[model samples]
Target: MEEYQKLSLIDPQRVANLPTPDKLFLFLSCTGSIEYPGTERAVRIVGEKLGIEFIESVDQTCCTGYMLTCNAVNPQLALASTSRNLSIPQEMGLDVGVFCNGCYGYLRELAHLLHSNPAFKEVGDKANQALGREKFHGHTKIYHVQELWFRQLEKLTSLVKRPLTGLKIAAHYGCHYLANKDVAIDDAQYPTFHEEIYKALGATPVVYKERRACCGYSVGRGFTHREETVLPHITNKMLSAATAGVQLMTTTCPGCNTALDREQKTITARGNAVSIPVIDLSQLIAFALGAPVEQLGFKANTTPVLPVLERFIK
Candidate 1:
């Protein structure tokens, strides 16, 4: 089989492009909007601190990604729909910055398809032709804001008014970010985006067995596999955090948030004692950036970061 063929059916280009100056079209995933609204708040605050302009688009729809994952939507329709969705950001002439891992994965997948798949490209081209407007040139770069933060590591470190120096955290890099080998993100074997970010913010990153395990968000939660597969998978991740004395666990996926956060209580109810906080990456970033604790959405969390908040205040 060919190398690209070995990647997931969807592939995202890992190429780097120049940064553009315009209002960044922030793409919101369904889970991110309602469940983790604080994450949206964090992204905006961080962007403001960095002087990065951004705009949110309500015209965009759900990446409809969950449907595509469960074999509900065909690739052709998914691809075209995603192309239209991405065009919203392109209108701003700025590269899109995605906070949700699912949106990142889906947008990146389509970007790769437009570049590599003639069929997808043709469909998109036809649609653009019909509108007689600019088509997706596939020039826009897709990024997880975490990547931008990584680029500004030194500046971020300087601006960290409240460093999480002694806070032990487990960084969860959700699967969608690196399932495809071609778009292979940061050594999938031992990805470290979250860990590196934690370290830069002055915290220790804990590596655990469930570091790479699926959160069972889309499937396990929707189905009756919570106890059998979901719990075990989540338990493995949390137990590692607990054993390592990690005070908190962070995730980039809302679905992962759903699994890790909501399930933490269930784990405790089962006689397993855990004191760790499950937080979104944005929450952690916001916390590090010295945003007020209330703004970080700690209140919405199941495994609250109150202790962590107490430390920041002190």
Candidate 2:
């Protein structure tokens, strides 16, 4: 149950007790940027509050991870594209910090594979060559921003703009991010930093039955099995959280947000779903940090943020 026990997903060299870089390249996943703009805006706002500078890239595109996992594309193609994205951070001389759980998982997994396996690295390198880009060398370390925030609990607590004293917040850590135990904020089996994140901002973290359950977005369940698989799975998750009196659920993955927040309408129409609102962890942090309500872009949420915002937004 220690770093040594977990498969070495994070670069061992980067594992020593080193100060987290104040400036990091924030890799905005496709969903986090366009589909759910609040995540990007809120991340920027929260970064400002933490006094951390975020560097972005116009050349960067989707992590191409969704397809990679779904087997729509070969690992070579996935690795090649991921290399180009990682290169942007490497050239800037900073580690990559991702907000989306999907991006974090794909980028980290791709980087680790390329770094440790010469054959995979060669495939990625050739793919990069075809695009007239530098070969995939896996030079930069990848991290989820949540990991940074998790380590700064005291700092976050010190900067609370509006305490969510009576709020019942549920922590949806999602699946992929935690699967990589070596890199996640805490034990993937029983993550606590998320609950801690909620508590630090003065909200009560709800402990629900499916707190550790998969949102069923990954592994092609969404497309291959929605009603038969994804819907029922997610519905049960919602059932437990709502039954526990959850007001809003916070997630690290946009995919999970789509499954848990958007699908509630479907479940509700069928007469058996909870209308619990879902938002990215960053938006919640931005809210607690007093980022302007308009800036957080809660209106983008499928489930109304007003249910929770009305409590604090004034």
Candidate 3:
């Protein structure tokens, strides 16, 4: 076995060997679908430009990892949900590519747990048995869409119809994406892969103090701790980005996109006067690759992205 594949024996779902996937079972996020459909559109657009086929299955349901993380759902049910969703891709002989960090992290973590631990394997077996379909064999590999983009960096660079020259962009890796350190592409403490991607698009990537900070909306924290925690936490993060002169912030997760994009208005309302537009990394890639602004769905964002769009896209 190759060194990377050997290292991934413990967690096969997070194999380090980056394959050029021509077709992928695109794992859809409920939050991304409802709140920011544009990100999904951007993913499709980018995929098209890259000549990759993304398969969306209606049979694939929510990963339920969100509710599981929120402590609102039973553990077995969450495992079962993950098993069912993963089975769809596995049955189709395609690896899973997720756009949201929540889906990416949860699916990988849960799948790893189900396969590695005999106790959880029992749970997965039972869950599959109950459904009366193919048992969860843990064959499907889970990957974040960003990894795929990084894998195709050369092709992506070639497809950049609108280079993001002189635009200052910052990256928010999101907590969930970094949570699985063993499977991540770069160091958790100091990642620069996204910055490298920005450079590929001819944009100046800014590294701010709080670029790696949690978006404060995970696991229902936005609702439970808005005033006491979420607001102040987000406020500080945005201020740090503003201090770094970030024109646009890109997130790997739609949940982080929602938190960072929506909370800016809240921060501004409270007199902080910080308004940095946030968008999905895929959406930004789509924009740079000549996808139309209307197709990107910037209108749904609370913080207007017109200034950033007008500055670079025109």
Off by over 4 Å in 1: 1-23, 125-134, 180-185, 222-226
Looking at model 1, residue 219 earns an lDDT score of 54
Instruction: Please tell me which predicted candidate would have the highest TM-score against the true structure.
Output: 3
**lDDT, candidates in the order shown:** 0.72, 0.78, 0.83
lDDT (10s digit) by residue, model 3, range 23-56? 9899999889788999999999998888879998
Off by over 4 Å in 2: 1-18, 130-132, 219-225
lDDT of 1 by residue, 148-201 (tens): 665555667788888888887887778777665565446666666667678888
Candidate 2 CA-lDDT value? 0.78
The numbered model that scores best in lDDT is 3
Which consecutive 10 residues in model 3 have the weakest lDDT in total? Answer: 1-10
lDDT of each residue in 1-314, candidate 2, tens digit only = 01112232333243344245679898888877775898888888877877788999899888978668667456777877887778778778888888988898888888898899999888777777777877756778777778777666678889998899989888888877888876554567776667777888988877787788888776444456547667778888898888888888999888888777777887888889567889999999989988888887778877788766777875
Worst lDDT run of 10 residues, candidate 1, spans 1-10
